[model samples]
Target chain A: MKGVVFVKLSEFVEETWGLALWDELLQEADLASDGIYTTVCVYDDQEFFSLVSLIGNKKGITVAQAQKAFGEWIFTELYAIAPPGAHDFVDIFEFLHGVQNVIHVEVKKLNPDGLLPEFDFLFESEKTLRFHYKSPRKLCYFCEGLIYGLSKHVNQEVTVSHVECEHNNDDRCVLEVSKVG
Target chain B: MDKNPPPEALDIQLLKRKIEREQKARQIAEQQLEVHSREIYQTNLSLKKSLDYAKKKNAEIEYLTKASYDVSSELTLFDILQSTVALTGRFFNAAHGINAIFDGQKVQPNSKPLIWSSGGFWDQNIELQSFFFKHFPLERAGAPPEWLIMPIDENDRIEGQSFRWIVCINFELGNDSSVWIGFLSKSELIDEEALNVLEIAKGHLRSGIRRRLSDARTVRRNIELQETATHLEDARKQLIQSERMASLGELAAGVAHEINNPIGYIRANLQVLDDYLKEFKSTFKLIEEKVNLTGSLSKQEFTDTANKQDLNFLLEDAESILKSNLEGVERVKEIVEGLKSFSHAGDDNLKQISIYECVGTALRVVANEFKYQHQIINELEKTLPNILSNYGQLQQVFVNLLINSAHSMPDGGTLKIYSELSGKNLLIHVEDTGVGMDEQTKNQIFNPFFTTKPVGKGTGLGLSVTYAILEAQHISIVVDSTLGKGTCFTLGFTVD
Candidate 1:
């Protein structure tokens, strides 16, 4: 996990709840970086989940909801890291398709130390785009939230579902995104 | 409080963002640099591999080129095979080699097993010969395998200069014949690439051998042609002499008549002379009686006896008959002399002789062939310089020319024989104003058995024999003929 993810999350927390709440979550959580994250550094994966859980508890929500919201909130910030052709996708499905081919290649070049997920596609139909997401991190919910954010940014209607899940002991997660009427 | 920070605080925030941006840019640049370096390293490695391959191929090409030169430089098949053995022995890292060939004539080939070795040529070993034939059989049932490997006396000994292992490769030509190149070494020589190159070298070797063999065959055929030419020369000379006598035989009737006419007259005149001798004897007896008995006889009785014998007429007629008989005998002798001179055989020694004599003898022998319609204009210069030539053969040459000319003029054309002087050379021209030949026939006039006369009318060897005889004397002959005009044969003799 790059520190850029944490930095984007902190900005999202501070912008929504104010700097005071953001600091309270960071001070309470045991972070090696003391929650002073820089984009160029790599931090512990558990530390990221721990901070997300702490914020979820304070807001009286489930950890899944908080993580999902954080993924949606931090989408625009992470979108900045995408290489040129990954932007301006016509819809959320197009953006998801570009994630593996266009965005990930450039991301790997920039942060080679980061363990990126393997992305393969199955064009089940013209409207339905199914992609197999295989990663040790198993961030399926976060990926769903990213899709939700991308749909809003591109101003197109989309429905996201999963035919298989890593959480259910499948080797990879197959997320199916479809255009909505 | 304002949502925007103070100017000093804004400056610090802007500076932090600037530092992070610069750090990220530097990291991407470093990543690109490493990737490019790795690619360059891989390219360098590939180029090195390609260079190695090219060097190996170049070495192979040079080796085959050297072998080609070796194969071509040698003149004989044995030498070529020997040279190939030397080249391949070193190339395949062998200690010894043997080359054998079968010439397809007989099962027992002219197989000289020329062994090449680092030491020298073949060191003859009777045991090795037996061992070789045992492995490579003389009458193997089918086409032999491309290669064969067999173990030699494997006693690990180099002192006796024998190999432990041997590889025999066979290059087969047509006619169940092949050239076998066998290499021997203490260790196995199993370089496949070298063997592949050896196959290409085999092509050069096969053609080189083919050329060498073709050369050898040509030389052999040339010798045979020379021998045939010699035999033909001898036969031709014999035929020329025979033809001289044969033509005379053809004229035998005319010659016999020329002799018989004079003999018939001389015989009749001798009978008369005998009678006259008897009459003179009677008269002499009468005279003797008159002188002895009365010492004087009457003129009336003498006159009466003389008139009874007709002495005046006998005296005049008998002298005339004796003179004519003597001239007849001389005519027979001249014809016989001509026959003897014309038919002299095998006397091909050159002597200084003029063309006029040859023409004269040729005319006398072939005179009966001419007719009242045929005109013999012997324009041969009597004072022509004498040239070196065989007398009998030259006369036969002229006889053949005259007969051919006479035959050409079947309807009785002029047969003009003449000679000219040109720069210390004598040129005899035998021309006929008959049905002349075209350019094509004129070109082949001197070739053997080439003639315009019908099948049985000509042997076609007249001008060929004449040309051969003249050629032997270092003389030149040319034919100038045109259709419906005339044909002339010019013999030029360098007579300085």
Candidate 2:
């Protein structure tokens, strides 16, 4: 797991639930970092799972649902921080495309040991793009939320559909995107 | 009240179930949003690559336009190659380069490569040229592609040198004319954009070579046309001169014939008048004798009549005057005949005749000119075979030579005419023992309008016309002379 993910999760929790709930989630997670994170550092994947699970249990929602909500909330938070090599694109599509190449390349330079997912894209049409998401973490739902957040930032309406999911016995997650409005 | 209220507990359980369903729905929605973001990100990466490729291609095209303009502006091969090298270096960031022409032969190892380099000439290791020819084999293949890029080994570098790349391009200018441009640089590797630019530069070099060759061909053709025009103009002038000389010969022959007829009658009438006067003197002397026998007239009267008539002086001078008059007419007749022969020689038929015999005939024709002052010697080669030649023209040439030989000596001298067979040629030599010409005079002796004779006494055309005649017959003449010694004119005629 990357420290950026942990830091984004903490911000989302504190903003949506409140400071007390964030402290409670940190105490429950028992991370060695004690819930503190820097975007350039790497963290254990187990810590991220523990925090998501605690949030789900306290909110009476499933762990998968918590991760998806976190995905959506974290994108808006990441934009606010506006790190170098990010938030410089004019279009949602441009921003989204930079995630794997430009933005993630910068990320690896900052945190070389962090695990990053592989994304392979096939442009389906003028208004549609499709990609296969591969990672052992199976965070396809989180990727879906990031797409929506980007579209919202650019004030464009788009649909993100799951063609296949790793949970359904697929080797990799596949997603499709199309402009709706 | 009980520890837990029944109504509140039921309401809390219902609220938890509703929230669970709503949360599951929200999860699905958020997942879709994430998927779309990833898809757009992937697409943008692909688009960026495409955009970069397009930009690179556009820049290459621009380089091609500029290179083409620079190269084609020059009209010579070396100029074209120099410009090509400069542009290629600039485009590829090359430090040194060679633009060579191999003449499509087996390249020699020691041969120097034609090059234009930024840092001045470095003795390129001969191994490099050999290696280039070995791989490219431009001898068999006229051109080595329009564009090529490859790496030069760092280990192949000369002492302290650091270039690591080589790019070669070929331009075929037709007729096995080809130019090769090779660029060398210290850069580690050339990118695809620079390679693409090299391809376009190759195109520019090709057209530049083609245009220069075309211009050179045009210039050569123009020179040939001008030469042909000059030759035609020269031939026209020669034709006009020939026609004028032909007409002058006809007029001279006509005048000689007309003068010869009158000279013939004048000599005969003068002889008849001399004979009749001698008869009259004899009859007068006999009548005087008969009168003296009869004693009819006094001696004094007879003597007075004889003296008044001047009979003795008339008797002495009458025969002498007639003989001198006849000799004058004969000399005029001989000169008229010589003029006629010389002028009408153009009409004489060609035949196989001994060149020696022609010299004999010429000696007789001009015997009068030499008989007075010079001894004529004939050393004709008797073993010489007959040659096919114009008899009258050969005679004329010999006659002119004999006359010139006679005029050389005011005092008596020897004139020797001889002939020999040398190879396939008949060589005739005319030697004179009279005053020869100086070096300056000998050089211009064969030129028209050049004569040693006082003006009006000579036309200066004798030797000049003889030269023209021999030249027309493909005969060569050489005059060897030394002042105060003698002149020898050697005529060589090819005999087949």
Candidate 3:
């Protein structure tokens, strides 16, 4: 009941990284859903999940590849939102380790500007969770969007976004997400 | 027969051989004798030559030694001069020599130098006199003999000039022996080269003259410095003593004021006591008189009671005793008030103070000394304005004068103090009819340490200190006195 869910990757990326590239990526991957569908990302030390269940028609890749792809996408999203001038993967890892809860993905057709999301996933912990994303240019933008989306969805603005690991491969992704507000 | 025949031929051969050997030995002996004779001849020739050369060298050394001894022997200026003339005359074979010394004033020829020479050429040669005068200028010349006159200097000024010349009959001796030397008459010529020898003999004359002049100035300066130091020391001592006396005066004033406060009350109390005692005695006396008049008593009983009490005499004596005690208390109070006023007189700053106030304060302070002894009469002008002065110092001046006046009067006398304003000056006069001072004593009265009082009774600095203080403030004091009659001191100061 408390797992993360993404109804649409476009809405999720728009709210997290503050970019519309996620809509293009979702259309290319053909992963769009109306009902709630859950996407889960598991790593060696930590795990994350998103559930999307279709209300009308579901168009996307297989669930396994979607999960993997979501993992890579989330990794890229974490890198985009990471702080500027962060060189060491460990520093990014520690930053992501802090936000263990309070992260969510949602899709909403009524909000044209994507100003509001349906669901928000938040990581909650005493320590900060840090990670690196593939798109280094969009790290700070993504982190700022994530914080704004989390503050708007939870009505609690005291959430922190962090990077968990180095994003060395475009296909393989790593992230540790948490919530602090 | 054959041997006899040949004898003559054999004899001839033997003779020839013998003769040849003998001739050879004789030739060798003759050559050895010739060598010995030549060696003896050579030795005699060398010995004779060495002896002649040694004799010649010994004579030359003796002459040189004699010349050196003769030249260095003359040390003093006179001796050097005399010997130079004598040696030159002897060397050049001249007849006479004359030496003249020139000073800036005159040229004096040495008499003994000319007298010693044989010829009287000095008297004959007018050219010599003119030559000497022309060459040896009176201002700058000295002992002369070598055609160059050397000036003798003491402290870098030419003091004397000596001229030396030879009177010669002929010029063969090259003008050496005819030299004559003379020195100036006014200044003594010292031998410069023989300073060590001549200095011992003339030490007293030169140094004595120099010291006499310098010592006089040194002695006068030393005396003046000593006198100044002594005066300064005396002033220092007097200043210290005056400060002490001022402090003592203040202490006495404070004590007097403190005593006056109590004595003032005590005197009042005693007056009341006296009055009450008088009233009690009078009442008691009246009762006794009334009792005696009204009551009847036995004669012996009345006599006994009268003898025991003596009420009439007791009443009479009580009034006198109370009166005397009250008078004594009043006297104590008066003395206290006088001391207080004298001590507190000059607490205020300097201003134009009335001379009368100065006199009053001084008299009050010394009132005990003058109370029953001398009568002070004040003839101060009522219209006289106050004079500008430090009030305390003025009071001190007045006190000194008053005390001096009282001291002069062993018995009782009159002291008249008066002041008047003349032009811009205030004249204060203290005249006393006491034992006056003679001229000698009065002359030295203002000198420190000159006192008539017995030793330890007076420091003798009071009048001199007062004189100094007054003089420093531009005030003058004049004294008029006649022995056995009176003395008056007038103090004058410029008014503001």
Candidate 4:
């Protein structure tokens, strides 16, 4: 896991629950860095799962729901961290489309060894965009949260749905996002 | 203790449930962590791909920049085309690439293309060449634009292989000049970046080809000008020679007529003198006979008188002297006559006459010139019909040809003259058994002032004049000759 994601999660937990819960979860997880994280360094992904699960249990929510919420929170955080020029996206469709060709490519430039999910834009129309998502991490719900987060960031009204889900034994997850009038 | 133990029992059961819950939570967290770890690994793989693609695109841009510079700087069109083909192959990862220019002359579908390809495959494939020529427009109206894309037919393929993608970029240089760059792949579809590279390369190709065409035109124009100048100089020389020949002919005709009068008197006077000599000899014989009968003097006295006069020798040699003189005068007359016939000008009357008669007259005119050295054999067909033509000019032409034949054989040889009636024409052949001319000589044999004879011996105008006269009469002449074998001059005259 990227240290940035971990940092964001820690911030999210500290803001939602409390700073003491964040500290206690880190200690319980027994991370390699002993609860210290930076935006640039890499960390074990297990620590992230442990922390999120603990947070989920404390809040009486499912693990998937916690992951989805974290995904939405990270989206807004990425938008804030992005350069001002990144705000030029016209709508959620534009922002989501850029994820594969533009955003992920830039990410690779920033971190030469960084990993990113594969996104293939299947089709596009005036009010709709569809893509196939393939990743080893079965995070289809997280991708769905990103689409909704894109809509929120662009201040646009849109509906995003999954026509195919890898969790349901599909080869890949297929997202169909449509713009609202 | 069995019925209602302390509250500690209920608390201990709740604690066990709590511990089980914690264990279940840890298992789920571990599974999710595994998924997240896989996701990171996949994302890294994707990142590597992105970097490679970026590197490929960067290399493409660098090559394109270099190609642009090379195209503009290359001195020749061939170099530019070669570079373009090489770069295009690299850009598209093409299996086959060709850069071609349409040479101006022929562009038939089967015509050889002016192409440069990376491999020898295109040169070996005739069907591919045909396909290219059939599709490419060698000539167009208002000129084809700088760039065009030619689509390949889905059903069309090459070299027993199917190509799903083939892109042809035609870069037109003005004035029906253009270059075509083609990239072909069997499986890989050309992407947007490749198309972009092609578009950029076209401008360079166009300018390079344009410069080449301009240079070619300039060189061609220079050659044309040089050729025109040479032709004009030749025409001037021919005109001067023609005028000089015309003036010489007029002078010759006047001299011939003036000489004809004296030749006539000299020939008549020689005949009279020969007759008088014959009379004198007979009178002497009669006197001798009378003297013998009368026996007026002794035999010694008569013999002495005869010896003193040298009468026997005089009688024998004097006749031959007069005959030789007559022959000389006759030769002079014939020469004057030949000169007059050759110089004869003006459109004379057309007379319906047998060609045999003309050949006979020509033979008589040139007989003394060749009779002693060559035998003249005539194979004229008596059944041949007469033709309406200028008798005098035809006789002159024949006379000149016979004289030429005579001159060809300084030693004894046969001069064969024959005629045959072909379809609507009379074909006359004058063949000689003499040393014939070579190819070069035969080619220039009828050119004015061109001759193989020595400077003083020949005017070099005989055959040329003959050619002019025959041409004026609408007759065609052909010469077939082999060195050391013979020459045959065939003349065709339309018979009406």
Candidate 5:
């Protein structure tokens, strides 16, 4: 069956882990699909473990053990299903390509309408992004939907893949995506 | 062999299709995540911006509250205005500010609003306008900037019945605009409060002005009252002096007449005695010559000489001198008695007194006043009847007239006092041949305080008091005087 999976985390545990854990986790992990593991760890700490047990009534582990398990899982299970730009190297390349297309098509469409489009998005790894578009309404409509879809997926707390687009203003076909966990 | 290769190629195609589907799903999730991250970042930025703005707003409110508190602290009108202008200037960052108050008629911009601000900033020629307008050329003109023109209104109405006021506030450094505050009522500017500071100030100004005006009026009225009181006091003193003089004049006149009668009889008697003494001396001389011729004469001859000399006649002449001196003494006594009666008449009842007797009594009292100055000529009619009157006051009136007559005759002259019996009335006249009064003097002669004599000599109240006395007794006195000739004062009384 094809379906989406969702998980609600404790807000307190998420805040306690903060942005520092995300940065360190992203830097050290080797995210590649080798089919050697099954589960991935997002945040780990003694406080987070206790907080999770209180909220979910699950077993707990120390931060050091969870960090080692998260690194091993990223290289195997999480990478297995991730798209082409799931890792940093592919994600940066896809994002630059997507930004160029968005800027060109939206600016061309918005020049006649005298409106600037603004938007916000979130990744599955709890990373936020913002943008202001000096763009036209027709192009901004698609960008707005795409950014909204990305924020919805991030709310589900899952990993994502990155991709680039081939279409410009003349063509309505474009492919742009980035991975976050 | 061909069938086995076909199945393997089909399996590879299915796997490629599945991988494409999974990659597309992953791309969708990544886009959603990026969008959510951007939204959170934008929300955080907006929240920070709003918090900063609120902090600044609170600071501005605090500053305004402190400024208003300081402005209301002053109590006096001038101080309040000054502080209001100063605080408003500081708040708006203006250079110079001025408050001009109105007088009733016109706006005196240059004049200091109070006596205390004598040396303060005062500017004239400030005018009221609908709005503060900058003088700009038509080419550069557009919709002008808005100016703050707050009018100080007393009764919530502003228009024709408004006070004249003009306030000019200069711009601060690097600014070119100014704010103007004015009032519709002069009184509305008091106490520096929003409700009616100007009105209270105007009220104070009006009260101050009114107080000054009333003070001046009171001072003028007091001066007038004092002058009137002094005049009244002087009149009273003169009245008293005149009455005393009149009594003195009456006494002098009466004594003069009495002494004249006695002196006249004594002179007559002395002349007769002188003649008798001359005759006796001649007879004695003859006897002496006869005795010398016949040396030893007989006693019979001496007896003949004594009989010839008439010794009884000499004794009779000596008795006559003694009798005449006694008569002179009696005449003096009569004069004294008449004076005493006239003076004491004030204690007696108002009765029907003979007109002749009244005249004589008055003459006796004023005998000394007219002693040598004038000769009194009485032309009293024998048929003159008595009149019902206050004897003392009537005597005083008579005496005043007679004395006035004597005074008129500075040099010796004849004073004629006469009476005529008319129907039910007796008209008595006292006339003097002396320097008479002119028309002007005569008109005011009976007016109290009107005097023709030198100061300190005559109090001029004599005739006036005399007129009053006679009038009180229901009698009338009329005077007729010819300048450089003589005067006649006529008294008319009703007979019982």
Candidate 6:
């Protein structure tokens, strides 16, 4: 995991729940990073899971819900610093396609060793898009939330369905998204 | 203060942490820029190398194109050698050139090479020859390769031009000579690219020399063939003339026979007349003696001698003999005149000669040939217009035809000669009912060296000469023949 993810997640938690709750979650997390993350450095992924678990325990939510909330926050935060190409795509599907294709390629160049999930896409139709994903982290809920967050940014209504998830019997996750009528 | 810090103290601590995090992010951003800058520099370096290689290759291609065009355009070997050396020097920045041409194995002759400096043509040809003789003698003839590069000989630099290395390319010139075109470089070694460019020029020069030499040989061969044809033509003309002489000889023999018959009877008649005159003279002489001059006998003696001589019968027979002798003399005169006209070999000027007269003269020339073996049929029109033609040549044409007709009738077949006036033309036909030729033989009868007669009996140039004479007169001949029946030769002489 890249330190940027941790830095953005911490920023999201502090902004949504205030600095006192973020300080409390950091204290309880017992992280290797000690809740100090910089965007250029790498950190242990387990420490990231611990931080999210701490946030979930303190906020009276499951770890999946905490992770989903962090994913949504980071999507908007990342778009605020999006490249010129990302802003050119007006539709949610176009934006999501650009993120995986254009943005991810550029991002990979910057952080080649970052533990990013690999995605294979099928634009089943103009109205539907499916993302086949595989990762050791198995962050299916986080990717689903990222799709919902992109739809929010474009003000487009889309239904994100987990056709298959690593958490279930499936070996890899397939998220099928459809535009709302 | 309470157990937790007050708002001012907590806000100061939070402000300090925010500043520290901002400083750290700036440091990381600067490090990323350095790594990206190194990668960008590497990519630019790779692109530069590729562009340089492409440019070098393009130069080599352009050089080869120009070099080949320059070499191949020259037709002569000397011009090709000079042009190739000049192109090589200009291409590789060479300062001077030297070319030598001589024979190697006759299959290829090297271009006689005199070292040509950048200044002008080499005037010292003898000196250059001596230099090559002293160094690369004829004994070095092992049939060298197409190209060679050697260090400039320190022993001999005739003009002393400070030439570094010499690149010599050679190809065949002619059977008697070889050619060498050498480019003299300056100080520096030529690079691989320039060497590759020279290889292309070598290929063009090799084939150019070969093609130009082959072309020269072809031109020479054409001239030789033309000369041979001219000699053959001269020989054929001479043979046709000999054939004409042979015809004249035959005519002479025939006229001799005709003249001898008339002369023989004329001489006998004269001898009889001489004896009768002598008797009369003796009787007269006896009377003259009594009257005047000698007075050797009496008048009565003269009367007795005259009475004994039988004067009336002698006088009458003498008149008949004298008349016969006069007719015989006229016949001999006519035969001699005919021989004179037929034997006029130089009478070649075109004139309006009567076709009937020409045929008559020809028949008379060969009259003896026809007398014993063949029957003659002459139905020629005397009123036919005279043709504008050489009299002697036409005479030769008609005589050859009449003789050939007579010869064909070996076992006494009919010989028929006639004339007809077609539109603007007079057609003379000579027919024979002898051994006639087939279509193949008929077609070839007029060709030189074509003969149906026995080898010693015929020169085979008779009809060929006839055809040549007719063609010169712008007259056409057509022969119609059947194997068993007869043959007719029609000469169509256009009347002017």
Clashes of each: 0, 12, 73, 3, 59, 19
The iRMS of model 6 comes to 2.8
Candidate 1 — number of clashing residue pairs? 0
lDDT, candidate 3, B222-317, per-residue tens: 999999999986766457356427534534654465456557766766776676567666655755775788775566755666555664565566
State the lDDT of candidate 5 residue by residue for B1-496, as single tens digits: 5756675575565445435534654665566567768977998899889997776555445445544454444344345455555444443333334543433223234644321112333344233222122211112112222222354345533344444222332211112211223322233342233223233333333343334445657889999999998997566445544575556663564477668778888888888778778777877787788889997556887777767887667868778797988889877876777666655534324687777787887776677677565788998865678788866667767777887777788778999988777788878888889899899988999997787777766657777878766765778888899998999888888877
Compute the TM-score of each model's chain A versus the native chain A and list the values: 0.90, 0.85, 0.23, 0.87, 0.20, 0.91
Which is the winner by lDDT between candidate 1 and candidate 3? 1
Q: Over all chains combined, what TM-score does candidate 4 have?
A: 0.38
Model 2: runs farther than 4 Å from truth?
A: A1-181, B1-75, B108-111, B120-140, B143-145, B153-162, B173-177, B195-197, B230-234, B241-255, B259-496
* Tens digits of lDDT, candidate 2, A1-181: 7667876786788779865576677667777766656554467888888898899999999876787788877778777765587867977667767888788788688557667788888666768888888888888888888888887778888988888888788776888988885
Q: Highest lDDT: which candidate? A: 1
Which residue pairs collide, candidate 4? A115-B43, A115-B44, A116-B43
Please give the range of 10 consecutive residues that has the lowest summed lDDT in model 2 chain B.
Answer: B239-248
Q: In candidate 1, what are the lDDT values of residues B291-355, reduced to their tens digit?
A: 68888878887887778777778888889988998898887777777778877785678889877
* Residue-level lDDT tens digits of model 4 in B1-496: 4887666875565456445534654564566678779988999999999999999888778778877877668457767776777777766666666656564534424434544354633454556656665655555423644444555667766657665666676655556645566666655455777677667766666666777788889999999999998897566445434533553453454445445645766667667667657766765775588678886756676666666666666666666666766776776676556555544553446768788877776775566556456887899966778887777677767866776787788787998988888778889999999888899999998887887877665567767767876776678999999888788999897887
Better of 2 and 6 by DockQ: 6
lDDT against true structure, model 4: 0.70
- A20-99: candidate 1 lDDT, tens digit per residue: 56667866896776665666456899988888888888888877778778877778777876788887787676677678
**Which should have the higher lDDT, number 3 or number 5?**
5
TM-score of predicted chain B versus true chain B for each candidate:
0.62, 0.40, 0.39, 0.37, 0.42, 0.62
Q: After TM-score superposition, what is the CA distance of residue B291 in candidate 1 from its true location, in Å?
A: 6.5
Error of 6 at B464 (Å): 6.4
Best by TM-score: 6
lDDT (10s digit) by residue, model 3, range A51-126: 2211112434443334443444455445444344322333322333334322222122222333222212234344
Supply candidate 5's per-residue lDDT for B455. 74
Worst 10 residues of 5 chain B by lDDT: B170-179
lDDT of 2 at B348: 32
Question: Sort by lDDT, best first: what order?
Answer: 1, 6, 2, 4, 5, 3
Q: Which sections of candidate 4 miss by over 4 Å?
A: A83-85, B1-496
